[model samples]
Target: MTSFRQSDRLRNVRYDVRGPILTEAMRLEAEGHDVLRLNLGNMHPFGLEARPEIVDAVAAGLAPAQAYSDSRGIPEAREAVAEHYRRCGIDDVSADDVFLGNGVSELITLTLQALVNPGDEILVPAPDYPTWTGAVNLTGGVPVHYLADEANGWNPSIEDIESKVTPRTRALVMINPNNPTGAVYSEETVRGIADIARRHDLILLSDEIYEELVFGDARHHHAARTAGDDVLCLTFGGLSKAYRVCGYRAGWVVATGPLHRAADLLEGVTLLSNMRVCPNVSGQYAIPVALGAGAPGSPLPADIVDPDGSLERRLALTADALNAIPGVTCVPPRGALYCFPRIDREMFGVADDEAFVLDLLHTEHILVTHGTGFNWPEPDHFRIVCLPDEHVLTRAVASIGDYLARRRR
Candidate 1:
C-alpha cells in the first residue's frame, strides 16, 4: 500500500483557527467535557441569528433553487450586492461586476487561484484572518506579512507596506475590522493603502466581511471607494458575520476601480466560477432581502441586528475584564467579534502560545486560538471571540484570568 500525503501546495499553508486546538476540543467533547470554543467568529451557536425576512427569502426560493443558475450568481442577488455597494458610495458598480461564491472563504480561494502564479507575492497583514494567508499559499503564492502597528490602534503601517513591495508583488490584501485584532482601518489608512496599490500597479484585495459590525465611531472605509477609478480593487463581503448566517455560505466579490484594466483577471475569475457551477442557490436568495432590509435609508429590525447593542456591550466587558488581569493587556476592540490580548510572556514564563492555549483548554476547558495561527510573528497574543453574552463572557474571561494567575512566575 502507498502512503498518501497532501499536495505540496499545502506545505506552507496553515489555518490554525480550526487546527489542532479544535481537534483537542472535539476530543474533550467526546469525553463529555463542555468546551467553550472562543476560537472562531461563529455567531449562530451563540444565539446570533439571521433576520426572519432573510430566512423567508431562502425558504421561498428553495423550489427554484433546485436548478442551477448562472455561473456568476442569481441575477437578483448580484444586483442586490451591487446596489448595496452603490448605496455605500461606490457608484460605478453593477450586477455584472459581482461574482457570488459559497462564502468569502471560497471566494478568497477562487480569487487567489485566478490571480496568483507560482512565485507571485501578496502583501497580507501580520495578524490577518488566517484564510487570506492560507489561500494565498494554496495558490502557490508567497504571502508577505506586513506588520500592523499595534501601538497605533493596530493599523497597517503605510511605510512597512510600501517597503515590502517588489517586482514580484502582485497584490495588497487588507482586512478592515481585522479578525484576531479587531482594528478597523481609518479613512486615511484605507486611502493610503489604495495609494500604494495605485502607484505599484498592484491589485487591491479588501476583505470587508465585518463591515457592518463596527462599534461606536469606528467606521469601515470601503477600499473600492478609496481605490477610485485608476487602481483595480476587489472587495469581498458576505452574510456570515453581520447577518449571522454562517452556515448559509453566501458571499460575494465585487470588482471595482477600472474593470477594463482587470479584464484578464476577471476573465480568469469568471472561468473558475463557471467551473464551480454557481454559489449555493437558496443561500444566494438571502442576499437581496438582507441588503434591501439593511439599506442606508432603511434599517434592519433591532431584534435581527444586534438589538439593545449587546454585541458592543459584550465586547467592551470582555476587553475590560481581560485588561484587569495582571500582566495582560487587551486593546479594546472598536469593531468585529474578537479581542486579541497580549500577555507578558516573561512574567508568565510562556514561550509557545499554542502550548499555552492547549494548557488552558485542558485546565479550564476553554478553547482559544494562538496568535501565530493568524500569522502573527510573535507568540505573546491570543484571540477570543466576544459572541457570548455578557454573563457568559465575564465568566469566561474570569476563568482565563484565573488560569493566568496560576501560570504567573
Candidate 2:
C-alpha cells in the first residue's frame, strides 16, 4: 500500500471563513440549533431570487445545451458579455476575448494558473478575498499583501502598493466594492492603481462581481476603463450577485488593452477552457437576458427596496444596528452585502477574532467569519452578511451586545 501525502500547495491554504467554523455551524444547525448565519456573502440562501426572464431563457436553452458548445463559451453568451463591457465604457473588447466558466471562482483560478510562474508575485489586498491568495499560492506564485487603508474608508493606499512591488510582481488584483469590508474605490484610487500597474508592467485583474450592488451615494469606477491600452486588464463579473443567481455558476472574463503581449497567457486560458468544455450551458444561455435591457417589472420585492428602489435604507439599518452594539464598530458599507466590524478586544476580553466568533456562535447562536479568514493580518475584525431582514439583524446585533455585556461582567 502506498502512503498518500497532501500536495504542498494545498498545505499553505487556510480558508477559515468557510472551513472548520462553517462546517461546525452547519453540523449544529442540522441538529436544530437556531443559527443566524452571517458568514458567507452568498445571496441565494437569504431569499434573493433570480430574474424571471433569466430563468425563462435558461429553461428554453436547456435542451440545446446537451451538446458541447464552443470552448470559450456559447457564441451568444460571449457576445452578450462583450457588449456588457462595452456598455460599461470598456472599449476594444470582443466576444473572441471572452472566456466563460463556472462562476468567477473558476475564472480566477484559470487566470492565475495561466499567468503565474513559480515564485512570481501578485499584489493582493491584505484583508482580501481569500481565494485571491489561495489561487496565487496554488499556482506557485507568492501573494504580497498591500494594505487597504482603514483610516481612509478602506481605500487602497498607493504608497503602500508602490513599496510592495518587486521584479517578481507580475499582476495586481483589484476587488472593487471589496469583499468583507464592502468599500468601493473611487476613480482616483482606481487610476492610481492603474498607473502603478502601467509603471510596473503588471497585469491588472479587476474582480468587479459586485459592480451593480453599489449602495448609498457611492459610484464604482470600472478599472479597465481608466487603465486604457497601456496596461493589460482582465475584468471578471457574472450573474452571481446582481442577478442573484449563484447556483447558475455563470461567469466571464474579458481581456482588454495590449492583449497581444499576452498571447501565451490567453492561449493557456483557451486550453484550460477547452478542457472544461464549457461553463454550465444553461447559465450561459441566460446571460443575454440578464444583461439586456431591464425586465418589465422590478425583479426584487418592495420590502427589499427603499421607496427610491435603492438598497440604501437597508444598508443604513444594518450599519446603524451593528455600530450600536458595544465593542463593535463597522465602517458604513458603500457597496456589496457585508459589514466588517472591528471588535474591541479589550472591551469584550476577546483575545483574537476567531475566539470572539466562536464565543458568539456558542452563546448567541450566530455565525460570522473572523478577520484572519479573509487574509487579514490581525484578529481585530469579523465580517457580517447584511442580507438578513432588518428585524432579524437588529435582534442578532442585540444578541451580540448582550454577549459583550455578559463578558465584561
Candidate achieving the largest TM-score: 1
Q: Which residue pairs come into collision in candidate 2?
A: none
RMSD of each predicted structure: 1.6, 2.6
lDDT of 2 by residue, 236-333 (tens): 99888878788889998999899889898999999888888878788888788788724445333222323354355556777798788877788898
| TM-scores of the models, in the order given | 0.98, 0.95
lDDT over C-alpha atoms for residue 129 of model 1: 89
User: lDDT tens digits, residues 222-283, model 1?
Assistant: 99998889989999999998888889999999999888888999999999999999998999
| Candidate 1 Cα lDDT to native | 0.92
lDDT by candidate, in order shown: 0.92, 0.85
In terms of lDDT, the poorest run of 10 residues in model 2 is 298-307
TM accuracy, model 2: 0.95
**Model 2 per-residue lDDT at 365:** 86
Which candidate should be chosen as best, given lDDT against the real structure? 1
